[model samples]
Target chain A: MKDNIKKSYLLNIVGILSIYLILKLLIGGNVLNRYHISIVIFICINIILATSLNLATGFLGQLALGHAGFMAVGAYVSAITAVALKSSGLPDTLMLVISLLVAGIFSGIVGIAIGIPALRLRGDYLGIITLGFGEVIRVIINNMKSITGGAQGFTGIPRIANFDNVFWITIIVVGILYALTHSRQGRAIISIREDEIASEAVGIQTTKYKVLGFAIAAFFAGIGGGLYAHHLAFLDPKTFGFMKSVEILVIVVLGGMGSLTGSIIAAIILTILPEALREFANYRMLIYSFILVVMMIFRPQGIFGTKEFSLSSFLHKLRYNQIISPRKEIKGDE
Target chain B: MAILQTTELAIQFGGLRAVDNFNISINEHELVGLIGPNGAGKTTIFNMLTGVYRPTEGDIKLDGVSIVGKKPYEIVKQGAARTFQNIRLFKNLSVIDNIKIAYHNEMKYSTLEGIFRTKRYWKEEKKAHQESLDFLKIFDMQDYANTLAKNLPYGKQRKLEIARGLATNPKILMLDEPAAGMNPQETYELMDTIHFIRDKFNITILLIEHDMNLVMGICERIVVVDHGKIIAKGLPEEIKNNPDVIKVYLGE
Candidate 1:
């Protein structure tokens, strides 16, 4: 069983590294242009946002709607930190890491601050609270002229979140989320999602796990915001508004709630779909909405439907030459 | 000595008293049953005893600790776990995972440790996984470990719910209707399983059942309630012949 675990881990590592190296080679060879690289970075950012939100909305069974507000907080905090640290004579990589961490920490703290009061409510009540809180954060950033530049937007952040850096950052964040979602803490959170009352009766503290999930999701959203700020070299408060939260949520729902790999795949497709449809001109969004409507009417559980894609499952399918349904039970070493 | 004892326990919802003056005591390793007709407040007593509902007046001592203001999870941690009147297994989670989730408080590891995949996380998780399997083996559910709780047959779901509650290592197990939707054969099987678990775990049990045969067969003692009050309390034979119980059941 342990050997099976090791082999599967090896497969996953190889799979991830090959993808990263291919992207790196594409950029090195200029096979993909600057516009494509920017899109790739955006996809990475979306993956981070989607996976974190999946932790809260998917695994914890929450309906948080203020994700963009946390992202905005991270962007402003990291941008300011990068600007402050740029003159410290540190390596660019070191500065990027520090700013991202600071951004994540501040956003997570704000998450806890809001979560304490907000998490007390459930279902639509929590969603409304988070939506209102998210807008409030954006408004605060828009009004604070001394610090946030008001609605004019903060400019000239150090552009350290290039594809080379952000691709790896995205991998690390996703890895952390996967590890979390597969452990005891993850099961506790999932149990709360299944039935809050049953979970409490079974000795799982629902409120703590709910808040923990919310804070972690906020933390990752902040990290994604930090990456975006550096990638764009500017901070636009308007960019992280209600619609932005809806977009991230759409990725999560499109992927499949309670399925991490589904979230990743959905984030990738949704992020690139608009660019891929640019040939349609004015009909791009029309086509996109049409697909979403069709998808909802057909497969409302999302693409994966609470199931994940895994290397072992993929290998088994290839060897057997048949599609095997996703199994929940993985042997030891999981 | 009584492992679980409640004194004058009562709860009122607005103008209506849901359960009042409900007193019961189960000694260590005792199997006691609570029964009454529909809306007779049997479940309300379970709710108050399990901390789901705070009694308007009275004290509940679990292992001699006053658990009046504690939350449901805290009560479980204090060594009292319960199953709902309705089947409340984590429907989407695997059967093994449902048991493992009950082991959450028992396992000692931080969220950071779980995220980092630290040594302690693996150690605790492996122990939990193996123990959950062994735990499932008792109910002969090892074959269904990977099956989702909702997919289990109705009888197995009730058995699974009981098994999940036992995973909490509670000193006392409060079951609110373990045979709600089961046939005679399944009810007999549940009776055997409940009897076996009480002996194996050496824990006190308080059961609420509308199925009088199962209750009278397994329960050493019985408490009957009607209209938010205890109508009678004694040995099963006495409860079987109680005039008040017959009146409550058959009407006037």
Candidate 2:
């Protein structure tokens, strides 16, 4: 397995170099330098949000519109934690990592609390409940004058989150998610998604798995929120309101509900596409809505639609690299 | 001695009583059949036994222990397992996975062990998969280990559902309309499989079947019902000869 991975890694390096050259040429050096770092950062954050939501919407087949509420919980928790411990003067990297993890756990707990009752609902009822819950969370934050500062926003947050931190954490979280979705738990979630009744008959404990999926999604959304809070050094309840929830939902839908790579690609495109067309900034929201509508019409399942782009499939085409053909019959000499 | 007994087991659906004072006693190693015309509450009885619905009023005892008011999973843990009248295999999962899921209740590893993929978790998972494979091999379905349940042939899908039920390692396996969708050959094969499970696993079976031939061929005892009441209970030959059984069957 190691040898196979090594060979694949070598090939991937070559592949990545070619793609980088192509991207560099298409958009000139100066523009790429200025926008590339931020675009990558946005892509990472959107991937976290999309993939996490997939755990609920795609795997568990629950449509939750309040993911941003969980994200807000994480962001605020992490922001408060960082600020409270500011006097201790912890290292920035360590503080950032700890804050993100704390945020994830906090959001996961809130997720479990919300999911228990909310997931009992089915179809559009679940959607409505989640939407209402999202608004409720925002209102609570807006009213909490002492802790959340009542709409003035939480400022002076430590700016420990940068492109590198965002990139690595996103990679790790996505990697963990990929592993989970392929595991037995992942299969069980997918099974529940396909048919909850059959899943229960097969002794799946469907509600437990559904709640588990929701908690996981919320955990990462929180982490993503923590990343967001630290990146901007400021946050408000409005930042993680219903429209923000819709923004993340757009990412999940446009990327294909079950397609991780599609989500990542969609994230990058959605983030940068607007700024590239900056002259039409007034119509930015309009363009975003239009793109989603067009994509829905053309390919409702999104770009990949639950299938991943396999480098192995591509490498199989270069069969000239193999010493022995896979199809060849090797028998004892006659 | 009877491993499972139901006394006056009944279910009421709105204005109508679906099952009225239905009683059954299944001894260890017996293959029993419950037959009735449509809407006669044969499936309703199975549902009651499986805890999908609580009995309107009756005592269901497994080994003399009352299982009344217990949940479906609670009944399952008490040495009873069942298949749905319509096959309810976990569709998106692999054939092996469908069976392994039934073994989830038997797992000894904690969630912490599962998350870290600890040694205990690996051992339990390995054993679970092995047991699932062994169960599938009984139905000659080990080759389709990776095939999704929905992708299997109809006959194999039915067999997979039974395998999943068997994976629970129940003392009594209840199959609802097991031969509902099969041709004669498949039905015959299923009959053999039912006997194989009974003899090999030393488990009793209470089956609700629509096919008279398959039911009569394997069931040591038969209970016939009509309009939610037992019309006759005896050996197959006696059930076949009973006047009321004939009237209920032929709609006389």
Please give the distance, in angstroms, between residue A53's alpha carbon in candidate 2 and its true position after superposition.
Answer: 1.2
Candidate with maximal lDDT: 1
In candidate 2, how many Å is residue A77 off? Answer: 1.5
- CAPRI-style class, candidate 1: high
* Model-by-model DockQ, in order: 0.88, 0.32
Which has the greatest DockQ?
1
Q: After superposition, how far is residue B137 of candidate 2 from its true place, in Å?
A: 2.8
lDDT tens string, model 2, B79-186?
888988888887756787788778877776654455555677667776877888888887799889878789999888888888888888888999999998899999
Clashing pairs in 2: none
> lDDT of candidate 1 vs native?
0.90
Residue B186, model 1, lDDT: 93
